[model samples]
Target: MSAGTPERTPTPGQPRRASVPEFGHGMVVGKFYPPHAGHHALIAAAAARCATVTVVVAPSRRESIPLDLRLDWLREVHADTPWVRFVGRYDDHPVDYADPAIWDAHCVVFREAVGPGPVDAVFSSEAYGAELAHRFDAVPVAVDPDRRTVPVSGTAVRADPAGSWRFLSPPVRAWFVRRVVVVGAESTGTTTMAAALAAHYGTSWVPEYGRELTAHKLARLRERSPGASVFDVRWDSDDFRAVVREQQAAEDAAARSSGPLLICDTDARATAVWEERYLGSASPQVRAAARRPALYLLTDDRGVPFDDDGLRDGEHLRSWMTERFRAELAGSGVPVVELTGSHTARLARAVEACDALLAAGWSLADPIATPHTN
Candidate 1:
């Protein structure tokens, strides 16, 4: 027996009833190109009206975000909706009705995705809702075709992910990794600032992966060779590549599961810095990934007390490293937000830059273009 109490079969040639929520079962079909807040709202509204709502994600081979990712994302966003089931088909199907065969194929796929059910109503915010509903012997409920209330779409997000970032949930945002990188020399508070900024925004953050590796290397050296202090190999090219790879891993993992704004303590670029420091050159992969973020927070060591964590090269190399970072940024064309003064002041300054980006609809394509600061 179906979970929804089945109604009697219609009389011969009689039309099946068309009321949606009033009939206990409802359904919604969407591509959810990237699954933004607007999609969530639509799902929420449908779930509210029906006793049980089965959401069928439109499948396609041409999508940049894969169908599985979309399905997983939908599951995460609607996890609390036990009454709402998510479904999808894996094959070469149409995301848009580009060809005549798509309509027939899609109808078949839709039915397959929503098998063994008497869905009373079909919900959508597009013109095709009526046709889709008609095919299923259900009523059509168009929620918001205009997109006024939740003014966002997958196309707009794909074009400018950073700009449309505010519309995306963490799962969607994670795929893009709109990085806000805090970087500078030793004792410049890069680690401290990244944590504070993440906390300020109530978001997740990527810690300094290189620093973690350095700790491990130091520990192993001590265990193998007693009283041996040097852990300089941590900055070697091969090891730096490891740092870059692991840093990328942490960043990748954090991006798919973090809030709208994902913060990075330091990024692959830092590996390039270590490369130059030890070997007078940078790794190819690390150098490539060293592109500027939505914002480059270059920390200034001036007037700030330099408290060396045993790994730091003391207050001596602070100025040199700061200059190296500046020189690195000099060519990237990325707008720099130079942070100075006490931690509190720097945090406030960073917030100013971040707030302006959010206000301007932070674009993932060119995050730092619309520069703002005091």
Candidate 2:
């Protein structure tokens, strides 16, 4: 099961539903190109009226967002209502409400997932609700015919996700959040830059998990050998793997709660670089853990003085580390913004890069357009 969203006030024009549980099984079908509040409201309304609801989250395989992800988001959002069951199917069949054969092809897929159970009511906010209900031999119930109540659509959201940010649930928001990662050599101010950028954007930032692991290892070493230093801390491929896993987990968690943009001190890609610095070379698994982020802010160690925190012993290797990061990042294909100069200047440059990334609106491929889309 997916994680549940925290209890919060519903978005305006999207009313919360109270489960009265009157009818038998109800059905709701949609592409849910990117499930938003309006979609949630429709599902909620269905769950309210019926003892059980089967939501057919059918989208073409050609669509950008995966069917599994939509099902996950919907399942997580309505977790409180266990009666609402979510199912997915790749309905690549051509959509044409006027065509009876096309409708039959689509209904076959829906019926396959819904099983032989009778559908008492078919709920939808589209023009084809009545026809769909007629085919299912169920009552047609329209939730919101006009766009006034929930004034957002998949087309509008795909066009401008940032503008329709409020309509998205936490899980959906996390999917759309543009992750910006900051990485560099020791004392190059990656953490400072990350936090500064998050502050500037009024969003959440992910702190480096590798550093925390380093501290933990150092502390453990000190317990056995009191005189042990940061250099005495032993590292293996598994340690870097742990760093990569933990870093990504933290980044993903932050993305769920963050605004449109999320800032991070380092990511799995940087963890691979750290692995190379410690071990001879990055392991295959470690290298594979490097998931691409939206942007990377590589802090240049050109003029920045190195401050040796208790866990860091890389002052002498700062230049080498910086160069290695640059080399690795260059081939990763992610947009890199090298921050060099005074702290103030670096922040200004970071902000400019992030702003540009946000300005370039999300590019969600248009789903196969139907005459009446839910």
Q: What overall lDDT goes with each candidate model?
A: 0.73, 0.86
Candidate 2, residue 175: CA error in Å?
2.0
lDDT (tens digit, per residue) of candidate 2 on 239-321:
98888888888888888777788888988888888888888788999888788889999999999987878888999999999
Instruction: Give the clashing residue pairs of candidate 1, or none.
Output: 162-362, 162-363, 162-364, 163-361, 163-362, 163-363, 174-255
**Which stretches of model 2 miss by more than 4 angstroms?**
1-20, 224-227
lDDT, model 2: 0.86
| Per-residue alpha-carbon lDDT of candidate 1 for residues 34-82, written as tens digits (9 for 90 to 100) | 7877778778777777888888886456555677888898888777777
Backbone clash numbers for all candidates listed: 7, 0
Worst 10 residues of 1 by lDDT: 1-10
Model 1 ranges with Cα > 4 A deviation = 1-28, 31-33, 36-128, 135-170, 230-234, 362-374
Score candidate 1 by lDDT: 0.73
